[model samples]
Target: MKEILPRQIESLMNILGTIPGIGAKTAERISFHIITSKDNMVQKLIDVLYDIKENIKICSECGMISDTDPCHICLSPERNREILCVVEKPTDVITIEKTGEYNGLYHVLWGVISPLEGIGPSDINISKLIERIRNLGIKEVFFALDPDSEGETTMAFIASKLRDIEGLNITTIARGIPLGGNIEYSDMYTLSRAIRFRTRLNDNL
Candidate 1:
């Protein structure tokens, strides 16, 4: 059958389809919307995309994506200096932030250590985390990573490094999150329970 849309419109649809969770049908609708919409709409989208590419950067201190150097969260003086919460990604930080149960600062690991994937302890942002803990006089750190094997391995590795820091405490959410589950998907209540009933990790780690 001959294509209903022009080459340009079909190209747009194909591009949109590549986005995760936006399948062919949805991409078709979106492509149709964009092409039929005013030229200003397309122009605005192009401008924003370019702006995102030009302006967004990773926060040097926390590894969170931001438009500024340190990011607003790190610059804020009200955040708790004594406690830090380590998460696997920037999205997980947002998930935990939604619970309104924690006042501590955050660190985004960017990725976990997966031997099969060739990701190691040095690959992610661990050195910066150690530097932060040592410089900030942090008392405790909470690990809010996922419940999968990779998460466990990452936690175990991080715990080992923190042990050398005398007088510092390491902890993780107790039991609310399910095995193989991700913190990004867990509800706020469950996350709150996990944070509230967190357990301490020691030499047994």
Candidate 2:
């Protein structure tokens, strides 16, 4: 059958709809706007879309996205190297950073242990974390993972695995974040309070 709308327009809308927050109607609107926009704007978008893959890379030290080996935070002398904050995703690091409550180094796990999903420690960046803790003089480690089963498991796994480290304090953020909620979706105030009131993992949980 012949298509009612232009084939190219339909194709553009289909692709746009694949983006996480964009729905069908929003994708349609975006496609129309992009088509009507200045060629320079479209070309600029295209350039960056292509450039991100080449320019962006995972930080070798912290597993965060960066153009440098040890991201800016890891390299910065201003941050407290004695404490390390471990989070599930790179976005969580941003969420916690916005709170301004933590002034320490960060380690992005990149993922969690989801058994049904077949994702285990080997799949995530846990080995890198151990190496960092061993090499760096981090006195305390904070777990800022989500409240789901996967998050709990991941946090426990890390803590137990690092038990051999001497003089290390492993703790977790308080229950300010509701169950089933992730750090990325939490508000600034709640996240800040959680960080401020953090406690040892085994003591409270």
Candidate 3:
């Protein structure tokens, strides 16, 4: 068969296919749509991409991506200072925020500990969390990591490390989140219930 798509469009599709969930067919369709769409629409997308790259900054306190260093959540006086919610990624922070059941501070770990993958406690954002809990006088630490073996192992490891922290409580969201399910992909209702019914990490471990 004769070559259907131009080399440039093929290259674009290949680039798009690199995205996590975008398959080759979807990438090809998106490439075609981008080429066929209005020039201003394409320009707008390009501008927005540039804007994101230039304006987005990682929050120093919570590790969430935002336009500011500390992020609005970290700066907000209304948030509960005595509790902190720890999650595996910034997207999980956004997902939990949508549930509106939590008003505490957050700490994004960026990734979970996976021995097979060579990720360990030192590899993710653990030290800062420990420092925050101790220095900030946070009374409770709520974990909202993905419900999987890696998540469980990570939580247990962190809990063990935090055992020396006097007068501190460690907890995790309820099991309403299905096993192997991701907090970022969970429904708001399930996440809400999970937060509302959270249990002590010691009890589950």
Candidate 4:
């Protein structure tokens, strides 16, 4: 077998490594797999990648990825139009949907506001969210952000903005030590539950 050139493999590995969670070793494995795959399979993969680049676009109304402007969720009549769930990414939308607990629409922010990362309201789609709330007459907004410091800060900012909006309700998920957590490693379920079930911020403290 002829030896593969270091520069050739290295160039491909570098680009693949740029993807989140894909390191050099994994990239090399994937590159080898792709190069050794059948011609049809490799051609199909290449075609799909190019098609996604050419066709995928953000939904104008909800910021979800879609081939069309509004996306299926925004256009679906079965969805509850009055309720809106705000999530940090499109993947979060899938996670929540899997729970089968929510029947509302979604607004994917694409990311959270993080000062350390130089991200702000403008960096995401908060302005478009505000417009959607007002124009679509959304009655309730659920903040389904991750359970982290930045998520908390983002929720606070959004709540403050919607506080005075009449006929609109803002809510967040309940918190507890996770379902399968050991008390030893757990931060504090009592504290977490206290925060989750608290009637107000002061009550929790």
Candidate 5:
């Protein structure tokens, strides 16, 4: 087919298509929408992106992306400080929070351990998690990682490390989530059930 789209529009479509779940057709539509809109949406988007880039800060304690060092959850006195929920990313934290099933503090690993991908325990936030649990005197720690192989591996590894901690309970979310499902994509009811019926890792491992 002859080149119908302008060079800049084509480039924009290509860039947008690179985003996950966005196909070429969807990217083309979005690009046309951006270029044709008269509400100065593009400029507003640019401004928001720039503001996010400049102002976003990772939580020093939990590795969550927020505007504060410790993040609101970490600073919230209403949360259960004795219990910590370990998740893969900051988005996972948000997902669990929406369910209202967990009111404990969170520790975002940022990513899970994937040996195939050359990501080990050190690459993510495991060390800090261990230290945080000990320092905070956490009594129970439950993993909310995805149900994939990597998520399992990461959870098992962290559970083993915490084994030596005296009187600490290590658990994983129940199998309410499908074998390969992601925590972030799970329905609120399912995720709530998973957390509510979490099983002790010691019993399985």
Candidate 6:
């Protein structure tokens, strides 16, 4: 392979380095690979990137990425409209759907409440969620947030807001240590199930 000029390589590295988790070294490696690879593969990648940028959009109701406004899941009649699952991100919605245990609609919050980061309820799609609850006549809301501090704080805030609404059953996923055995590296599923199965929050003895 011919030697890559410093200025050209540096320009490519700067662009790729802007992506999260990609540092200068990794960016240079990727840039070199892309430049040295076959022209057809690179063109295909370019085409796909343009296609995604031009066609993709967020689902109007759930905030999931889709080419359509309502998205396939939202339009599907097979889903249970009475039950709505609340998730932190669109990717989380996809993950839960892969489990195949749930057959309900979803509401993606887009993010959680993190006061330390200056991200509050208003920053996310909370108002749209409230409107959905009131207009759609949903029967139950399942909170499927992450098993972290921000997740808990967001859940509590949402629960309090929904308390006054009548005939709504709000529930969180169950929680446990995790499947891996070590108490340290528990996945979200185990932790979620543990919380779901938690005893009364106010256990006074």
Give the higher-lDDT candidate: 2 or 6: 2
* TM-score of every prediction relative to native: 0.90, 0.91, 0.93, 0.82, 0.93, 0.81
Tell me the lDDT of model 6 at 151: 76
Put down candidate 4 lDDT per residue, 73-168, tens digits, no spaces: 899999999989888888767666655567789999888889889888788889889889888999878776666767777777776666667867
The total number of steric clashes, by the backbone 3 Å criterion, in model 4 comes to 0
Candidate 3: segments with Cα more than 4 A from true spot: 1-4, 203-205
Compared to the true structure, candidate 2 yields what TM-score?
Answer: 0.91
Superposition-based RMSD of candidate 4 using all C-alpha atoms, in angstroms: 5.6
Candidate 5 C-alpha lDDT tens digits along 1-205: 2198789889998999999999988998899899999999899989999999998999999999998878999999999999999999989988998998899999999999999999999999999999999999999998999989999899989988888889998888996899999888889999999999998887676
lDDT of 6: 0.76
Q: Which residue pairs clash in candidate 2?
A: none
> How high is the lDDT of residue 16 in model 5?
95
* Model 3 lDDT tens row, 27-132: 9889878888877667888899999999999987888999988899999999999999999998898899999899999999999999999999899999988888
Clashes of 1: 0
What is the C-alpha lDDT profile of model 1 across 1-205, one tens digit per residue? 1186788888888899999899999999897787678777888899999999999999999898899989988998999979999999999988888899898899999999899899999999999998998898999988898878888899998888778788888888778999988888898899999999888877557
Better of 3 and 4 by TM-score: 3
In terms of lDDT, model 3 sits at: 0.89
**Backbone N/Cα/C clashes per model:** 0, 0, 0, 0, 0, 11
Off by over 4 Å in 4: 1-8, 176-205
How high is the CA lDDT of each candidate model? 0.88, 0.88, 0.89, 0.73, 0.91, 0.76
Q: For residue 15, give model 2's deviation from the true position in Å.
A: 2.7
**Model 6 vs. true fold: TM:** 0.81
The residue ranges of model 2 lying beyond 4 angstroms of the native Cα positions read 1-8, 202-205
Residue lDDT tens for model 2, 19-73: 9999989998998788888776678888998899788888889989888887999
